[model samples]
Target: MHYALNVYGADINPLAVLISRVRTARKVEFAIGAIGASVVKRARADRRFGIETTLANRDKWFRLEVLTELSKLRRAIRSCEELWARRFLWVTLAETVRLTSNDRTSTYKLHARPKHEIDGRNVSPIDVFSDLVSRNADSFAFFRKKLRDANAVSHARYRASTDIALVDNRESKKCWADVAPFDLMMTSPPYGDNQTTVTYGQHSYLPLNWIDLADIDPKVDTELLRTTQEIDRRSLGGRDPVSNEEEERLFAASTTLKNFAEALPDTPSDGHIRLVRFYRDFQASLEAMIGQMRQNSYMIWTVGNRNIAGKQVPTDTVLSELMEHAKCSTVTMLTRRIHHKRMPDRNASSATMREEKILLLRKR
Candidate 1:
């Protein structure tokens, strides 16, 4: 059994104990993806279902198997209510619809800025939901009701479980406003300036602003406040310039980032600086994360090597380097090929990133 498990690990990227601990959640997510993929494939195959075919063969086959397995894995996820899965499925279905749509209305138009080229048109949430309904009306109806009930139950539970008192620290000036013990920790840190795709500042703005859990208290100290505020500002539109001739030289020397920079138009000064600062901050976040975990705690992150300027910026490798510098141990690194369905080659000329490494680490 041990030999078999080790071989499986080798095939999938060596699985660390930390990652193995979350096998259940990973399995559930895999199952869900499988089921969702199958539904989409079957729908596309039967044009009578009105679902258009937008996925490549690789994606279509992957989704069919993963999504179908998800349908079967529904029985195994602990503490997972049917409603949660249903809601997730509905959301995924909506995404699939958007992915397959031929209309261009949904694509983001950056004024003179880089835009992600997708298939024909922008697909809407409604369109996806409609597709789901047409294809699986019975399942659709079940999830709809289940989602409503789940929200109600979640709200009640949050109101009833008052173990950790909420303290506002929005305005706080401290290295970390508060430190709380976590049961498990998983994160995919930024690879580097050139390799990362998801902008942390832009991606997190709405959630940080709207969610009460992230509310800042007025009593925060000045230093911490300024630091966080600067971060927020950079996220919005701030960019930090590369500090010296040395740093600029380093960036220029990077085969990965140079390509990305050349491919991308000159970013607004503020935005450019923010990207650099964001990576620096990401490293800090990793360090802080390691510090916060208890001894022997687990950390699993999904990262990858991004291609920039015809060279690869292995984010997984960079992060491992950072973790080691912070005195953390490298547990395992799993390389996986995930055909991102949403990443479309509109121009058919831009470099595409097709694979990612799932890095698993442990804090000793």
Candidate 2:
């Protein structure tokens, strides 16, 4: 909507898709402030004491008092008549959960705070939710004002089209085919597998338990919340094992990948296996994306070179080679320094990247 262009996006994470959908929604709720105030008011007046989540060991991550308050908030949000407003409030509730939970805030992983610290801390989910709702309402109002000023809004709705879907890119050809072909593609794919890299699934696991799965997408499976790692396992390169033939084809398509694999130790280590599997899945996703682009279309890919077994994976070079094999030519490569990041400086397996490469390519 910022550029007033029709936009479409897909993500494996349901939470991600929910957030993206709200952000790109064509319809605007001009009464967002009123709706948010009503939610808080209803939550405060309700006296329900039931916990809402069925997540295993729920007490491990939340105190009884906090859980009770969250349950009240959840029920109140559910009473909302407007689906869009409810979705927005759900996001607010999710943020409140992040702040009030026993989980530490420094990292994406769901490690609990020290027992002493958790006990010493006094937080209220209701208060947090109220404040977030107020602040977010103001921010959204400001954004809509800007859009209106730019003539991007008409009759309280975005002028252009927008579509967001919950999808696995490796198998998304049909999804993209449902819409017109795109001329420009831009994405910053995962640096490596989520488990050893960022654990996006784990980051979303807690908040997801609180939000209604049905509100996100009809196809969203509750099984994704079965385990902390379930969503990550369903993500790219998470559970699929690379076959020898597929590996050979991938190697033939990108010599940089072949060289990297050949340089690893003869003894097949878990890290080596993960590296290859991630690339294999990435290749498939790239093919699916390329298939959706129009001829002479341009792609801007931002990639990071992650380390495995103390060796750097030349992701940018490898991606360029793969695109070349798919009949695309690299227009240029640009480097950008990472000034700030949510990832840890280093993990047990490897150091996080300090910079990233942006490759611009065109379909021939």
Candidate 3:
């Protein structure tokens, strides 16, 4: 069987080179499925690609044959011996979904899914899986090294408190919570909801559909993939757009958001609502995170400015303002250029983004 090698160019980050050197070289091991060319052709005729459903037309981006073969391969992997190895194979399969699709973008949460005129974007399951197997070997090696370097030993497992409003709920020790404050934190929060910005949920949807939840972890929520948009819906701005929500407190919290809302054009009211809902939810999350940090700790906030209604949303500036309200002063801000990303690039708003902002802050 012939397989193509995807070689990365020198344009990649220098850190990637360092990680590659540290990763212990190892042979890529994988379970070879009985899915042959004939099996693939047979599956296409077998009809599982939603040809008759409302989603039938999506075949333009995701060919029926490719989808069926992938589905067949994934479902069969569950019966394979060595549960841990099987789970890893399933993750590799999920990672290859975007690669096998006809869409130009490698990632999803499209803001909106686009229809491609070209019909040759679909890749065979064999090729996609093969490429992923090769990639995973190196990826895992680097991950192990990183974990070793960070000394990521197991810590006490405690489910996050369900209610953000309960900051002083004195029952934390009873629940075996990690009341010990964190020394530092670094996170790249979402630019907005998955539906509009990255479509992370949509990108994850196909892979989750193929991966059995029980194999990953018993605690894993199967409900997250119940709907194609379920994860995004559960995320900020995942609900139906409505302008009547009492978000005055949200507007009052950040002058940047307030000013942006006022300047929004009288079109796509849903967009307006999406922005408000996302920021409001984000504010709640920020407050929750702040509560977990030690005094005078360092935090690094990586964010991007997504365009909405043909205007650049001042994310870094707004974060600075919002953090001020949270009592964290911004130490400095830096801009990182995005060279080549797989995210959707067609949307005038939130797509075709070139740079992301990093905000270094200190908790007072």
Candidate 4:
């Protein structure tokens, strides 16, 4: 909407896709304040006391009181007549769950707080949800005002096409073919597999359990929430045992990758298999994204080098080489210092990088 251009995006994470859709939806109601108040009022009046989620070890992650309060909020949000408003409320509720749950907020993994910490905490889910709703509603109002100032709003709707879907780019099928031949592509692919780099799925697991799956996408399977690590496991390269043919194709396409692999010590402890599998999946995803771009289109990729076995993987160089191999030429590369990007500072498998590389390329 900022540029009044049609936009399309895809992600394998259902929660991510839902948030994207809610934020980019063409028709959005401006009465979030009234809607939020109504939700809170309804939740306060609600007498239902049943727990809503069957997440494994639910009691361990949430106190009994917290679970009951959250269930009331969920039921109230579901009662809203408008789907868009309900989706917006759900996002707010997800944040509230993150704040009120026993899980520590500092880490992506779902580690529960100590018994004393959990017991001493005086958090009220309803209060957190109410505050969040008010704050988020204000933010949305400001955003809408800016869009209106920019003349991007027409008849209370955004003036451009917006499409967001839950799509796994590694799949062979061109799920985004309907909107193919894009003139510009910009993305920040994961630096490495989510398990080692960032446990995004685990971070989302708790909130997802309380959220209505149908609100996210009908195609999203409940099996993804069966375990805290299920979503991460389904992510790129999360599943192990990279095929020899895939390794060969990836290494053949990017000499930098081959050299990096060759440089690793021949030991299971060297993280050789993990590195190869991640890059193989990365290459496949890159190919799928590039295939949808129009000839001569510009592509901007933001990537970061990750460490494996105390060695830095030159992700920028490897990505450039891979793009070149795919008949794309690098236009320029820029380096930016990371200021506030969320990352694990002490991950055992991968050390944090202080900077990121942005590569500009043109499809040939």
Q: For model 2, what is the C-alpha lDDT against the true structure?
A: 0.88
Between candidates 1 and 4, the one scoring higher on lDDT is 4
Runs in model 2 with CA error above 4 Å? 266-268, 348-350
**lDDT of all predictions:** 0.38, 0.88, 0.58, 0.87
Across residues 58-124, which tens digit of lDDT does each residue of candidate 1 receive?
Answer: 2322233333322232222222344334434433443343243222322221111123443222434
For residue 311, give model 1's deviation from the true position in Å.
1.8
Show where candidate 3 strays beyond 4 Å. 1-68, 80-83, 102-122, 142-176, 240-246
lDDT per residue as tens, model 3, 1-364: 0011111111011112222222211222222232223233443454444322133235554677766677666645654665545655666666576566564454465322354534534468756676666566566645544544554312311112211111111222222234436556676777785666776566566555556656654545666656667766766556644445447766666888889989999777666777887787677667766776789998898998998887888878888888888899999999899987755666677763689999999998
Instruction: Give candidate 1 misplaced runs (Cα > 4 Å).
Output: 1-179, 190-238, 242-278, 344-352
TM-score versus the correct structure, for each prediction: 0.42, 0.96, 0.70, 0.96
Question: Stretches of candidate 4 above 4 Å error?
Answer: 266-270
Residues 116-216 of candidate 4 have per-residue lDDT tens digits of 99999998899899999999999989988888899998899899999887978777346676778889988888768677787879889999999998988
Question: How well is each residue in 222-277 modelled by candidate 2, as lDDT tens digits?
Answer: 99999999999988779878899999999999998998888987543686788889
lDDT of model 2 at residue 229? Answer: 95
